[model samples]
Target: MRDCNIIKDLLPLYKEDLLSNESKTFVEEHLKTCPECENLLNEEIEIESKNTKPLDFVERRIKKETRYFTLAVLALIGSILIFIISYLNTPRHIEYDKDLYKVYRNDKIYTVEFADKVSGIDYTDTEDAIYLDAYSTKYDEIFNKRRLRKSLTFRKENLKTVLYQNHESMPNMVIGSGEIHQTLLPRLFLGFYARLSIIGFIGLTLILFLIEKFRKKAISLPIKTLLIGAPLSLFLGIIAIKGFNTATYYPVTDFKYIVLLSLGIYLFFIFISIFKEQKRM
Candidate 1:
């Protein structure tokens, strides 16, 4: 056989020290003089290095996030607790009982005081008038001290009128000049947003599917994901806050709770991903 071929056949044995000294010396001598064999030996070494060491790209990524694992878990747990607490504390519309609250005037200003059973209040302000609603959750009505001696003082000057909107529409109580101002239902705006969110969510999902299906240009994953999740979260949150069957008395409050719960769910996924990575390790 050729000297190079002989050296190549002996290379594996030489690397493991299984070759006799005489054979090793001969192969080493060939490697020193023959550039081709020397280059091949170096390439083999490089390949060996790559094969033995840790090569998981995902492992490096996991290391970067390992430090945040504990924080992610806490955030997820806290968010869930907050969501539960918020629901427990949230007040839904209640019937108006004159005994539940008493409205009176003092120093030409007006004040409305609520009993312990009436745990929450929501209101709206219009030109020269105020629309008010009372609410209570089961927990609040039963256990909370929040509404005990709770009083609202209104500046009876430019805003002189106060109306108790016991529920949606008519036969509500007015505490000031009996001038009837048209009261708009809150459900109109909130319900529209809820329905719009659901519709937009569906449309966005369809668009994302179509883009990935036939187009040569790839859709931006992040952009499409946010667009899809944003509306879906809103739709879900609105459904969570108030049922679609009727309008809620508190629109802004409902929106706030919706946003809060979505963030909690996001954190929960982050925690789960971190946990999976740790398990792999």
Candidate 2:
């Protein structure tokens, strides 16, 4: 006869039909000869039958929730990456070399210089033009680092003619004297929209994380929070766009694209989370 302790330990496995065939045979044979063991096995089987469905259902739910949690994490990471790239690509400002341009006049042949200090400059002859415009090397370097290609546009004040710069590269530092602006680059832009985008990204992330943490409490709650996150992101994006429109530094076009990209990333995360939730359900 098998030991009672050993048989009792195997009773739960036998009740779930999880024991190997040899083990099942041993348990069955032992049960037949042992009345006490037989009663214990029967009781275990009855108890498992009563609670098995509920227990299985709970197990499956936990597994599904864990999967959804992983998906949420991936979605958040993706959105953050999108936001960063968009910000980097956005044109913050134009950089120029202030000391890079000079003009020399010789009766008929006026000499212009941007020798080696900048990429290039384009000029438009205008009436009442008293000065040559130039920028410094630091200006060009700053722009190069920011990823915005720079060029100069010369507009004649008297002639009312505007020249669009088409220089292939920064002009060499020029030798000559002209009235100059202290700096070609604007010092600060008061970037409203860019700030908004950052705030919105951070806020959305926090909200999503909190909602996901307690999602198991009520399935509908997380879904509702997701819905809120998307719209709030869009609303903030729009506000940021408005701020961009008013700001002098970043162009309106850049603001629009940045907002659109941020919105796309935010929506993508929310939709994916919702889709995974539905699948698990």
Best by TM-score: 1
**How many pairs of residues in model 2 come into backbone collision?**
25
**TM-score for each model:** 0.60, 0.43
What is the Cα root-mean-square deviation between model 1 and the actual structure?
7.5
Q: For residues 1-281, what per-residue lDDT tens digits would candidate 2 score against the true structure? A: 44777889998888779999999998898888899999877787787788765778778888877777676676766777766555544433223345444555554444454545443332323352222332223434445544333343332322232212212232222332344222222113335444554676577667666876878454464465464565456545544434434433223444565466656566555756656665657
How many clashes in candidate 1?
0
Residue range with the least summed lDDT across 10 consecutive positions in model 2: 158-167
How many angstroms is residue 56 displaced in model 2 relative to the true structure, after the best TM-score fit? 4.1
TM-score of 2: 0.43
Error of 1 at 160 (Å): 4.4
Where does model 1 exceed 4 Å of error? 1-52, 56-58, 61-75, 105-109, 127-129, 137-143, 146-148, 154-161, 168-171, 174-184, 215-227, 265-281
